[model samples]
Target chain A: MAKYLLLKHYRGAPDPVNSTPMDQWTPDEVTTHIQYMNEFADRLKETGEFVDGQALAPEGEWVRYDGPGSPPVTDGPFPETKDLIAGWMVIDVENRQRAVELAGELSAAPGAGGRPIHEWLELRPFLSQAPETAE
Target chain B: MDERLLRSLIPDTLRILIRRGADFASAEDAVQEALLLALHRWPKDPPRDAKGWLISTAWHRFLDAARSEQARRRREELVLAEPPPGPASGKDDSLQLYLLCAHPVLTQSSAVALTLRAVGGLTTAQIAEAYMVPESTMAQRISRAKRKLAEAHFTEPGDLSTVLRVLYLIFNEGYSGEVDLVAEAIRLARELTKLSDHPEVHGLLALMLLTEARRPARTAEDGRLISLAEQDRSLWSTTRIAEGVNILQRALAQDSLGEFQAQAAIAALHADAQAPEETDWEQILQWYDELVSQTESPIAKLNRAVALGHAHDPASGLAALAQLDASLPRHTAASAYLHELNGDFATASRLYSLAAQKASNLPERHHLIRQAARLSGTDANGPWPGSGE
Candidate 1:
């Protein structure tokens, strides 16, 4: 069977009620979010559908190459950009339909106010091998 | 049933489950359960009819979930009262699921995930590994996507081109986790081609084949990246190249040229030549021109410059490079390579160093650094040329 990747995005999603800065959020909220995400992962594991997931630091550097006698330039955390990604998730499924189903469930994860965050997600499929004849 | 047979039947089984009105989410869960059951039972007492077994088992699992969720009561009634089971009657449902997954309401990423789950029969964990994300994150992503599908009004099927693009991306990833991405991509592409006779499908398949034919030579013995020019020609898969060529020939015969077909045509040119020097660079440049006409992308322009260097004068190639946006990834490296070819060592060295410093990934950085070191006649321990700091 083929594998597909489900991507989640928090595009202007409402901040949870306990939405303090990362450092200021009550320990319980932070712990709860982490624990919930971890527990959810375990559930996927039990079903043998668990793969891997990670939280991305919402910052990145851009590097550019200048011509000969020119030097490379670097940029980071540019002030103009607003749609910073908070984290991501990936899931394997049979087809696009199934992937959509899983993404729906993930969006239901409890957020700041212990309510569903209704976050946005993007699902992409992992390309597999060439057909046998092609090989 | 042999593992191979079981694996092959997964897509078909998933199609059936989805066709039976099992929402993409529930259908996937049911399929996963069926696969798990098969892993346990099939190894011991193999099913005489593997597809039948999977269909029956997955169908039952879907019913069980539907009953528990208390959703789709009307649909449940229809499923329970269906005609006695014969050969899988769910092919239509599966096709519909493909359409729904590719629905325009959802983002491309969600559509791809939904397609893989409903059509490919993979699990969230597998997809997560493929994307280097946690299973929980993947779960949430898929769940959100399905919810969108559930709410979406998919009046008509999506364009085949969109679906083909998604599958092409999958094949390009090559491999992840325990999954061979190339094989998965081909399987999906083959299935897609059966669903639609679009020439681009063939074009995509040919493109994948031609590119994959060089897989053996794409990497060095120690997993280092090897440029196409430096690849060991002997290791290139002639069989794959032939297959790609044959497919491209058929696609071209249609007299309709698409971006994929154009790209595949370029690949075919590379494959036809026995040595790099023998490559039909002029013809490839023509194809690139066609590609640019079809799709105006900076990366495409950058690639065209490389072909220009080979097909015409190096100075013209440099001029082409100058037109591209400097911020584009690999622009510096491409320019540096062109400079190196033009016998401009100082320029090449500087560009290489800049490219190396700006490299996003480790392997690319290492490669650029090596080039810089070589051009500047320096060792690793010493300060890079022009690095006064």
Candidate 2:
């Protein structure tokens, strides 16, 4: 099986079909959205497809080594222009088609009027160490 | 006791418990407990009869567990089977374990996990580490697999082919990392040979051995894939190749040819070659033909087209390729190679780039990118010749 990552973006991606900001959404709608995501992951777990998943706190810093002896440098929690990862789910699936299908289902999570989000998700494959076959 | 030898006793011990009417799940739990005790206790003072010790301990464990859980009172009725066990029951026990582990009700992944767990006798954590998955996820998977098996009456023996297919799947999916999963697969397949005399079993083992022999030269130190033709011939393992060829010859002599035997035959031919130029593509092509005839597999047909290209001419290969769907996983790559062979480097370059873009794995993508660069008359490692930005 191949592993795939479904990445949710706080910024940087092009506008999705339903482009309503999540903060503008009603509390009930946000609850519905979270419930849908949890159920989706639970279903994948039952199907033996889920690997690991977690939503990240939006507040984060970019750090780098200034030099061997200097304190590590830190940037803002998140600037408007900086690309931020909102959350991610990793799944192990039979093929790319299955990964795509699961990603599409996840993208259907409820949004601002409790309607489908249709949010653009960045689906990336995990680079595998193992090669299954020669021919 | 050697852990491998101790593990070898598990299938029979588990089988005896099962035959005495323990349900699959609890029996497995009991066997696992017994194994843990053995691992903890055996090294200091080894048992005189390892299998007997395990069976007795697991049986008592199952009884204790059954007694403690009074709500499921029906288990009390499952006292034991009346018939006396026979001498040759050992082989049948392991074979039955193989069949049950590869039950048709389970998906391929579940089958692999169950086979490694019940037969290979690996811990869930060990399996998780081996496959590079989280332990909780693997625990859930194994439980789900067991639940699926319970729904299907959990682990009744089936046909040998199903087990052979599972072993083949494991062999293909393996690579060395924390646990050398390929070696584990090879070890399990070797163990399976004693349990069944099926030619396909030997064929599958031979196929794995032959393929594994080339692994040393298959990839560069920097993790770049080296194509078979580009590989250093001196690096291939001759001992494994010899063993594989010997096994294939014996299987072929049985005169019951299957798809795996055909595949093994092709692998044997490739192993026989001392150099890229010495490969007998014609014979390889014929074996692919045999494989195709046996299974009507599209992959086999695609491989045959490649062999056709090398054996006859690129034109013949292209003609054959035209009959197959272009959407097949390696179709574009195969087409690119044939195009390059037929002196259409421009088209070959374009197809190679496309194939690289579509590659599912990193090594293959890198290899395809290199091919694209090669045909476009450029070096892969440096900047483009005429463009400086």
Candidate 3:
């Protein structure tokens, strides 16, 4: 089996089929969208596909090492320009096809007016343990 | 009293309890309690009918558990309607039990732990020891898996591939503490052979046997991985190799070739060679061709590239490698080797160092680093003092 990272981006991804943001949606629509995401995770847990999922905080900073015994340098928590990761769902699945199928479903989480978001999610494969027979 | 025989009877007894109205969790508990009782009592007074004894004891334990529950009214009704325990559907129940434990609803690790306990008939302590987990942790994992599948009704037969995958995972876990997972997997596969005559089951057993035969030579004294060509063939287990070959031959003769059978054929070719130079690379390439056609796995393609390097010229191997995605793990290492074979030592050295940087395991990373150093005419422990600025 292989693991995949289903990444949801806050800004980098293309526009969704349903373009309205969650904050602009009606309260009921927002509730429905949240419920949809929760239900999707629950179903994945039942299917033994879910490893973990979480909504990331919007604020983040970049840090880099300078040298030995040197204080690390930090960059701004650029919320406007940087390609921010909204959150991710990590899944262990039977194959890449299954991971894609699951990502497609996650991308369909309800958006404005409780319509399918049809968001673009970046599906990335996790590098697995090296095969034993490899030299 | 035969411990293995008693353990083998566990699934049958558990099925009897479930059919007689015990819930899955309670049935498992009852079976476990009955087994513990047998361990203590059977030595002093062995029973003539071990299966019957286990079934009866487990049934009583199930009833006791139900009676102790708060829903006494429902418990009494179930007890009244419950039929006397009879011999379970024998082979069918055992096979179904295997599928249930390996249910898709359970995680791989959970399925493995459950299979070792519920179907393989090993104790929780034994399974925990084998996996090198605390008993409580293994217990929680098994219980969580059981709960996840509690509502799963087996209207359709369990998938054979899933069961095989779980068993293969077990075999891959190797040995730990007092338990040998490899031996345990072989035992479970042998049991599976009795329950179902699926060729793939036999194929799996053969594959495990063949690969395990090389375990003694798989690692060097310092725990570094040894490539097959560099392994000391004298250290290989002849007995295991013979058995594996015999099983593989029987499977291949069936004319219903599957992926595992093809893989076993490749392993068999390696075991057949007396020395690395004598290896039948051409025959191995044929098996790889079959494997690639049967399963379009990238891993298979990577391996085929390695075989191509040996079967043909290095240029041909590099050409084949070019067809695959360079992003695949170990792609650089394979490229480096082909370059080295073609006398492009500088490029090979660079690629080896790049591969070392990306290596996932310490042993493999060290091996790649050494390869890079040797190609660069530097000492493995450290670079030569005047080698670089």
Candidate 4:
């Protein structure tokens, strides 16, 4: 069976509209959102289909290796970028069709104020040693 | 008289012609033409000596094609000079084809196709089917590869590693169209082993066999992906596993380890386990370490992280994963798994969603989305009814 990595990102949603800002969202709202996502992950784990997953901080540096005797260079946090990645997940499954099914569900991750984010999640397969019977 | 038997004899015949100085491309085309002729003629009147019939017919066809392409004067001169008498039959000439196919001039893909056709005796259609390319395209590829090799003066033989790589690519293609590439690869590997004494060749064959043993239990009834932990051990093929293990043991005894040997060692460890928990993660990790040293591939390191996760703490796996660049193949998936093991559900879920979207093939994409849905407590129903899609 092939495995895939599912990347989660926000799309088409207005940036935090509340006066309180995301950091000041009521503790209950924060708790509820965390619980909701947690419940989802726990359910997957129960099925034994869950492999692993993680959230990413938006801020990061891009490093480039030039060559021998060349110093590595770094750049980051471009102000012009729009699509911000929130996090990612990985699962081993039989094929691509199954990957889409799972992506549809993740696209509905609950966002700020208990609204479905309908986020854009990208799915990528892990290319491992082809299964023994593949050829 | 069966098609299978006829196909089985193709490699040997092609091998004989090649040894006598035919270039890989010409030798393959000649052999293929001979097989086509066999398919037409054998049913009506099976040849008394099938190998001899193919070698003689293919040899002449090869000469005819060579003669036709030359200037008339040169053709006449060559014909007047007379060709070498065909070697006595039953010489297992397939090895020569292997060497020619592995000619240094041919790119990996062309070499694989030529090898499969000439040494495996597989039809061009079969080779094309295996790669999911149009038959015409494959034909062009094979022809171009052959022409390139001919121009490069690629008459010298290649090492067993080249042949093994070709077989590995063939096996990796999985089943496509009407071709059973896995079985074909195994058959070719077996044939190659008979012709060479390389331990790595034996290691590669062993690795392929061991992995193939679990094909029956690799997927669900509905064609959904099944994880190793979830696979039914009972369904694994004991006979193939035994054969693989035996070969692996003999290869290991040589102690001149190669990548295939390391991979086979890992597979052997997997086979030894009766259940998922019983799997020897430490041994697998060791093999992966050896593999990384030998191959220095990011994928090997990624695999090693997974082994570490099972052998030690998930956190340790995550730590190892963190050291790898995200662009490395499977880095995201490996990170997601490591996070999931660390109880970072939100991160895991998000990664799953990303993986599902980025998936290149249908099965892997579907599997990723399923993971996302299960984590989020949402419906996991996908567009496809069954996984074979």
Best by DockQ: 4
Chain B TM-score for each model? 0.89, 0.88, 0.84, 0.89
B145-223 in candidate 4: lDDT tens per residue? 7887667764465666777888898898788468788898898888778877778999999999999999999876544
Q: Who wins the lDDT comparison?
A: 3
Across residues B187-290, which tens digit of lDDT does each residue of candidate 2 receive?
A: 88898887777899899889989999999999877556788888998999999999999998898899999998899899889888988889999999989889
**Candidate 3 at B201: error in angstroms?**
1.1
Worst 10 residues of 2 chain B by lDDT: B380-389
Determine the iRMS, in angstroms, of model 4.
15.9
lDDT of 3 by residue, B1-389 (tens): 78888887888788877777776777888898899899889999999999999999988888787877747567867655545555767678778789888888778999999898887778888898887778999999989888888666555556888999999999988874677889889889888878877778888888898899999999865455677878999999999899989988888888988888899899999999999999999999999999999999898998899899989988888999999999798998899888998898877877776775556554565566556655753322221111000
How many residue pairs of model 2 clash at the backbone?
0
- Pick the winner on lDDT between candidates 1 and 4: 4
Error in Å for residue B155 of model 1: 2.4
TM-score of chain A of 3: 0.94
Q: Which stretches of candidate 1 lie over 4 Å from their true place?
A: A1-135, B1-4, B71-97, B378-389
Q: Give me the runs in candidate 3 sitting further than 4 Å from their true place.
A: A1-135, B1-6, B19-21, B36-57, B70-73, B76-88, B132-134, B366-389
Candidates in order have lDDT scores of 0.70, 0.79, 0.80, 0.73
The per-prediction i-RMS, to one decimal, reads 18.6, 21.2, 25.4, 15.9
What's model 4's TM-score? Answer: 0.70
Give the distance in Å from residue B356's predicted Cα in candidate 2 to where it truly belongs. 1.7
lDDT value, candidate 1, whole model? 0.70
